[model samples]
Target chain A: MEQKKLITYTAGHASVRKQLLLFWTFFIIGSFTIGGGYAMILMMKRYLVEQYHWLKDEEFYDMLAISQVTPGPIAVNMATFVGYTQGGVLGSVLATLGVSIPAVAVIIVIAVFFPGFKDNVWIQRFFAGVIVGVVAQIATIVLDMGKRQKWTTISVIVCAGSLGVLFFVQQVSPIWLILGGGLVGLAVEALKPKSAGGASS
Target chain B: MSFLALFGVFFKIGIFTFGGGQAMIPLLQKDLVVNLAWVSMKEFLDFVAISEITPGPVAINMATFVGYKLRGLTGALVTSLGVILPSFIIILIVATVAHTFRTNLWVSAFLDGLQPVVLALLTYAVYSIAMGGIPAWWGYVAALGILLLILKYGKRLNLFLVLLAAGGLGLLMFR
Candidate 1:
């Protein structure tokens, strides 16, 4: 009877081991990802939900939604929020720090050295190519978003109008476009009939 | 720049930016490149490329790189802290009340409106960055080829490898 009780306790309540696992998991994810924030979503879902079963699919997605709605980088938000859920404040800190290690170390190295060699012709050529790759990646993201959107008249107008405004008025900050969109959305929602019952598609 | 001013700028950027790291690009370009002349547009593109190549959040990477450029190691630390603090504090609050927050009508409505605008801004970023980054005719061809490969292969093709390959190609082409 005592042996059975011991086995169960060891299996279920190894807090330190769980914390280490959490830290390591985030560290691995952080290390591998190239694009920041939005790019990490798939890996997060795969590791956190499918592999470890730390969160349900719905739960992972909910966190994603919340991350998007809130400020700061989505990657940081996910690390902090998911860490909190799994291991409290300590877990959050460890996970955040784990994820941050690569960015800090790598950027510091480049910051120290890259500027000194900025004028090198070969290095400049390599970066010029890399920027092409970056542009292609952004193009992919734009394509993906375009496919996902449900283009209504209002949404089309809003999108095209903002693009045109930005094109013409180079000095107009994007802050205004985002804020204006929100206010317009709020006003539309308020004007809707009570019987409408749900958000407009 | 002084540490306090650096921290202050990043902190404001951290709080003001919504959507994610990509969304912060326009603001960063406006503030850092256009207004302050801290880094030129060419250098800013370099930063973006570096951020994409490195691990962790792009926002954090940008903070560190820009900070280090301006003020060395301490600047990097301060800017990172500035960008991170808002998300950390905000998430703690939201995590406790996620259900309520998700169900809030006003929030959903606001996001719905913001969505289209965010798309426009992202598109603008692509345009602006591409204009400056891709000067040669072959560069555009390279970009198009890469875009096709990514679209066709999807996630099966790793981006890091693709970038490294492009660098190799750049060496040969530009030579």
Candidate 2:
């Protein structure tokens, strides 16, 4: 009989012969995740649009949009889902580390010696600029998501209505805001004609 | 709690926290502040403010600040490391094996669906921040202006200037 495909690992096919492989894999994954949160964001953007071609700019925006609203960093959450989907928990950890290693090394070094770097006003100024760049990047993601999802009158209504209820009115909580959106999504999808079900936009 | 216990607890938080630092705010508030009574509401608010104002992961800042407030500098370091340790350890584990895992199709679809929702939440967050942080009509106008400039020029625009400019404008108009 053929061997059964056991769910041996949450990520990667961690074989019995190569336990060392798993440890090294884990270490590298963890290190990278701690390091490269931002790089992962950019990389994910590229992967969706260019490599897999699974996500157009809008779908990429959708990925980014949901990633932002949920828990953890965008990199960790999205990467985890991707990794876990691939390899399980092990895969999740790998993607997490791949994204994080650069940041951990840099941040630890910075944290350890930030006192020394503290006096440099120019560095602070540069960081301030980095902040603006980060904001713009995040904003771009939002706009892209809107465009990608092809925010129809209804989606736009949901967006505005959610905004109003969330910020302006304050009757419902964010939990509800999300739930409401999901409901709206189900409704919208239901309303669409069955023939053109490829809501690709 | 023992140092190790504290380390373990924050480690769990670090590993589990999704949707960035802000997403964990309510749970952190409830567990540490409300239920456990590890911190007071005022102290929690102070930590929240500091985390938001400072750069880096908002959760890390809170962990450090709360640890320091509760014990001392050692507490700060321990808590900070604890918060990141799980992620650090796990990422290292995953990195070496990721290339092999990248091709799994089942893992891909779930992530696909989640992405759109996450983005929507963020857009909502931006709105929330604007409502709470902006504090004026001019503030809203400044946000729009900054957004426009960012779209046009991209990262070429300096964020420090943007923030300072926004703050300066806030001071000029509000004060």
Lowest lDDT block of 10, candidate 1 chain A: A2-11
- Candidate 1 CAPRI-style tier: acceptable
Per residue, candidate 2 scores C-alpha lDDT tens digits across B27-125 of 678778876688899867755653554444556666776666566667766777677655545544543453432133223233333334445555665
Q: Alpha carbon lDDT of residue A38, candidate 1? A: 53
List TM-score per model, in order.
0.70, 0.57
**Candidate 2: residue B173 lDDT (0-100):** 57
Instruction: Kindly report which residue pairs in candidate 1 clash with one another.
Output: none
The C-alpha stretches of model 1 lying farther than 4 A from their native spots are A1-95, A111-115, A196-201, B1-13, B16-75
> Please, what are the lDDT tens digits per residue for candidate 2 over residues A78-176?
555455534556655555555444333343444445534533545434333333333444465577566656445766676667656655675444545
The alpha-carbon RMSD over the true interface for every model, in angstroms, is 8.0, 8.2
* Model 1 RMSD, rounded to 1 decimal: 8.4
Displacement of residue A11 (Cα, Å) in model 2 is: 13
Query: Fnat per model, in the order given?
Result: 0.69, 0.11
